[model samples]
Each structure stands twice: as structure tokens, then as C-alpha cells.
Target: MTTVSVNLPATHYDVLIDRGLLDSVGSLVAKQWSPRKIALVSDDNVAPLYQERVAASLAAAGFDVHRYVFPAGEASKSLTVLAELVRQMAADTFNRDDSVIALGGGVTGDLAGLLAATYMRGLHFIQIPTSLLSQVDSSVGGKTAVDLDNIKNIIGAFYEPDLVIVDPNTLGTMTQRDLVEGYGEIVKTAALEGGEFWQLIETIDSPAELISNAPELSARSIHYKASVVMADETESGTRQLLNFGHTIGHAVEALANGALRHGEAVSIGTVAIMRVFEDAGLAEKGITSKLRDRFAAVGLPVTDPLLNSPQVLDKVKNDKKNRHGHLNLVYLTAIGHPEIKSIPSSEIASFLNLSVTN
Candidate 1:
């Protein structure tokens, strides 16, 4: 078991990760100051698993717990749902000192964090990430938002959570699709941190094996994210590295109308982008092929047949990640050695070709 503390500007919290951390949540919540009133937010899918236990923890801690469960899946990330969530908070009469705890995967963490950001202008919240994707990336960054008009996370805010509780045991119930989707991000973090960590992950054959008792690996990934976020909170410059394959991935996701999970699309996008690096002679050694096969082995697609679709190129050209018509491309020189480059419109099709094909 390894415990990592994420110290953001507004609030500081600990991420407790291990096989049996869920059973200890009550004691953990007890140590993190006392809030008289608390709003516990989750979706239908997650409520049955841990909501009762989370609510019980708050109850034992003497908090007035108000539970709200939204619909499950990525489709629920929208304005209409967010409006109703805010209404629920207002209807419950929650105030500044009171806190909201997001208990679910990425979808729940994002929507709940945004609720904390907007309620009465600002409030406190905690993140209990059930899925591996949420546990490593979305839950800790304070990047909260809802999707708008098919664009991923178009409406949102940078609201830090009061605490983040990551229990790997919670990942026991994840679907195979969900676990593979998360491996896309796990690969992304390894790229940023270094090749050594990436190599460590390569030895693990399945998502279940990797998430088993690997708190140190998980915490190390979060630590890399926090260190980068602390330096580039607004994502003005340096943090663009985090967008490695997301540019094309988001475009594909929007076109699919949320058909593919974020990490699933990213798995394909990362492979596609890495091929671009290889074509340009910018990539180092075997990292690209390794990434492609590793994610594929876990059920994440490395190639998108949809890449041949006409709209794919158009959407990439128009995505917000573009700057004055130039696409901000995060390409790899090698695993752990990332470089950002601007690719011309004329060359995008070639990169798209490599990215779209297996």
C-alpha cells in the first residue's frame, strides 16, 4: 500500500490506494477535517457498488449526507444533466463549507467536480475514482467538465478536489472494455514519466494483473500528473504534453457521438500519432510498435477504420486543439522523451493515413 498526497492551491488531499482501501474509507474520511453537511454524488452504475459504503462513512463521521445518483455512462456528461445536478444541490440547500463527494468513474468525477466548482460560485469536493482511468488521470487533476454538442468536455472548469480516495479494489468490477480504455492513459503517463515505468508496465499481461497490488505504480503516475499540473495549471504551455494523442482522439470521439470511450479512442489515436513520428523519423526505437501491441492485447484498438471517413480529417482540422489553422501535435522522440510540433494542413492527411490504418 502506498499513500500519495496531492497538494493543489485551494485544497490538499491524500490518495489512498491498495487492495483493501475501501474498507478503511471511514477512518480516512474521519481524519480529513469535519464537515457538518455533505452531498454524495454518483451515477446508477456506481451507486450499488460503493455509494452505500461512502454514505456510511460520512454518517459515521457525523455528516448530514444527501445522496444523488445520476444516469450512468459517458452520455450523461452534458448540460442538461449538469443543470439538474446543480438543482439537486440547491434544493438540498448546500453551502460553501459543505462538501460534495464524487463516487464513481471519470464521468461521475468530472460532473461532480464541476458541480463543486459552480455551486454558490465554489465549494469543496472529494474524488473516489472507481475506474482505473479516473483513478490515474481525470480524478486528480481538478479538470472537471461536461460535454457539449458532441465535443468532449467543452463546458467545464478547473476546480480542485478537497481529497481523492483511490481504492484499486474498486476496479475489480470493471468491464474488460473499461480496463483496456484505462490502459491507454496508463501508457500516456509512462511516456511522460520515463521508459523505465513504461517497461515495468509492459511485463504485466492483463489489466487485472496491473491494477492488482500496484499502488506505487499508480501513485507514481498521479505524482507525474500533479508535478506537471502544478507548473502549468491552466495548460497554457508545458501541459500540452498531456494532450499527446487526445487531439485526434477527441475528434474521433465527437464524430462517433460518444460511441467510443475516451481511452479507447486514445489508444487508437496514440498509435496513429506514433506512426506519424516514425514516418518523420522522429520516434526512437520500438516504442511505437510496443505501445500499439500492448494496448491491442488489452482490447483497445490501435487503428480506427473510421479514419478513412471523410469527416475525420475535417474534424481534426477544426478541433480546438488547433492554433490559427496549425495543429498542435504532441509527438514522441521516444517513450519518456516527448516533443511538441506544429504540423501543416497539407501533411495532416499523411499523418491521418498512418493513424487511421493498423
Candidate 2:
């Protein structure tokens, strides 16, 4: 078992990672809140796989458990789904004294955590992430939200989970695409702090391939993320470093009309940022080529954004992070170092257009 802590000013919590940890979640969680009724918020795909095990564990810990399963996907994250989730929580008689467990990937965790935050002002929650992406990012951070009217994570809040239990073995069922998507975030983060962490990524091109060899560093990614979020919890400032590939990534996903997974778009976004930086003379020699090569070696897309011009630009401009209408671009000087600049949309669009054109 491996453990890490996110010690923030207002929100402090611990994350526990271990294989077969689900069977012990009740005892592990019982250490936090004793009698809060437990609600397991799960997606349809995951409930059949491990929901019952979690329920049994919670029951053994001496709490009544309610499992609410919903269809899983980024599209399911929304006002309607959230409303239904709230109704289900209400039907379960959820209260501030009760707790909810997010028991799936990023979407499930986001929705479940948001529902917990809004229910009766606030409710206790735990994240039992089953996906690599969620295990390393969304499941730990307090940024929980549901898509509203097609905008990704449009309506969310900063509510930390009481505990995060990560069982890497659950990843056995994950697809290669999801694993690659997760690698994009991990590699981006590692590049943001290319120390031993980045070395860990370089040692293994495939995260799934690491499952049998290096589960510890896979869990260490959470520690890296925890440090970043703790320093900038509300994301009003430096926390944007975590948005390394996310800015244009979000735009790419929007351009795809939700056809691409979040991380895949992010992979493309990272390459786009690298390309623009190199072209503008911001990147070191050979750096851009290395980034592109590494990303491709991992099977991530760095050129998917070239498919559309006006759509991509429009999506990026519509992005809510563009405060003052200046695109705040997160770029890299090297792995473990980054620079955030606020550039005009017209200039960015033109730069990207040129990159796509030739």
C-alpha cells in the first residue's frame, strides 16, 4: 500500500493506493467518518464490475450503503444527469451527515463529487477511481463539475473528497486509448517537473505496461498532482500550470464535438503548444522534435487539431479561461519548467493557422 496527503489550508485529505483495496475501503474510510450513511455513486459500466464489493465492504464497516449507477461518459456529465443524481441522493435520504463515494472514472468522480458538494449544502465523499486518468488527476483534486448545455465541466465546485482509494488492478479492464490518454496527462505533468518523475515515464512508454513493473510511480503521479493543487487550490493563479496541454486540448475536444476523449485532445494540445513555441523561437533546439517523437511513441495525437481551423479557434475563444479575451497560453521552456503568457486570440489563431497550413 502507498499513501500520499494533500494538505491544503481549508481542505486536507489523504489518498491511499493499493491493489485489492476496495475490500478494505470500509475499514479505511471508517477511520474518517463513523456513521455517515454511505452512498456509492457509480457509472453503469463500473457498477457490475466492483460496486457490490464496495457495498459489502462498507456494510462490514457498519454503515448502510446505497449504490446509484448512471450511464457513463463525458456527455452524461450535465445538468439533467446531475439533477437525476441529486434526486437519487434525495431518494436515498442523503444528508450532510451522510457520505458519497465516487466509484468510477473521471466523469463519475466529477458528477459524484459535484452532487456531494451541492447536496444539503455539503456532504462527505470518497473517490475510488477505476481509471488511470482519474486516479492521477480528477479523483484527487477538489475540482468537481458536470457539463452544462454541452460545455465540459461547466458547473463545478472545489470540494475535496474525504479520502481517495486507488486500486491499480482495476486498470486491467481499461482500454489502450484510455491508458494513452492518461499517459498524456502524466507525461505533461512529468514534463512540468522532469525529475525522477519524468524518468519514470521515459522508462516505460506505456502506462499499462508499467502495471506489472512499476505500480509505485504510477501512484506517485498523484503525489505530484497533490503538491500542485495544494499550492493553488482554487486555480486562480499558478495552478494553471496543470493546464499545460488543457487550453488548446479543450478547444480540440470542442472542435471534435466531444468525439475525442479529454486526454486525447490534451495530447494533441500539448503537441500544438510545443509546435507554436518552437516556431515562435521559444523552444530550445531539438526540444520540439523530442516532444513530438515521445508523444507519438506513446500513440498520442499531436496533429488532430489541423482538421479544422475556424472551429478550433472559435472553441478556444469561447473557452472560459480566456479572461480579458487574451488567450493565456501555458508553454514550456523545458521539462520541469513552464511559462504562462496571455496572448491575443487573433495572434494565436494566425500562428496556429500557419502551423496547420504548411
Q: Each model's TM-score?
A: 0.94, 0.95
Q: Count the backbone clashes (under 3 Å) in each candidate.
A: 1, 2
Superposed Cα deviation of residue 232, candidate 2 (Å): 0.9
lDDT of 1: 0.80
**Residue 213 error, candidate 2, Å:** 5.0
lDDT tens per residue, model 1, 1-358: 6777767565666777777777776667777757568888999998998889888877886788899999998878888998898888888888888888899999999998998888889877788889888988889878999987667788899888767888887777887788667878887888767857877767767766766635756787888888888778778787888998887777777777767888988887888778777866888867789788778666777777676677878888877777766787887887788898887877777765744554
Best by lDDT: 2
lDDT of each: 0.80, 0.81
Name the regions of candidate 2 deviating beyond 4 angstroms: 305-307, 351-353, 356-358
CA RMSD for every model?
2.0, 1.7
| Model 2, span 1-358: residue lDDT tens | 8889999998788899888887898899889888768878898999999999989988988989988889878888888888998888788777778888999999999988988899898888889998878888888879899877658778889999989998888888877887677777777887888888777667776555646633565567788888888889998888888898887788778768767888788788888777778777887666667666667776888777344576777777778887776878888887778889888876777766646323
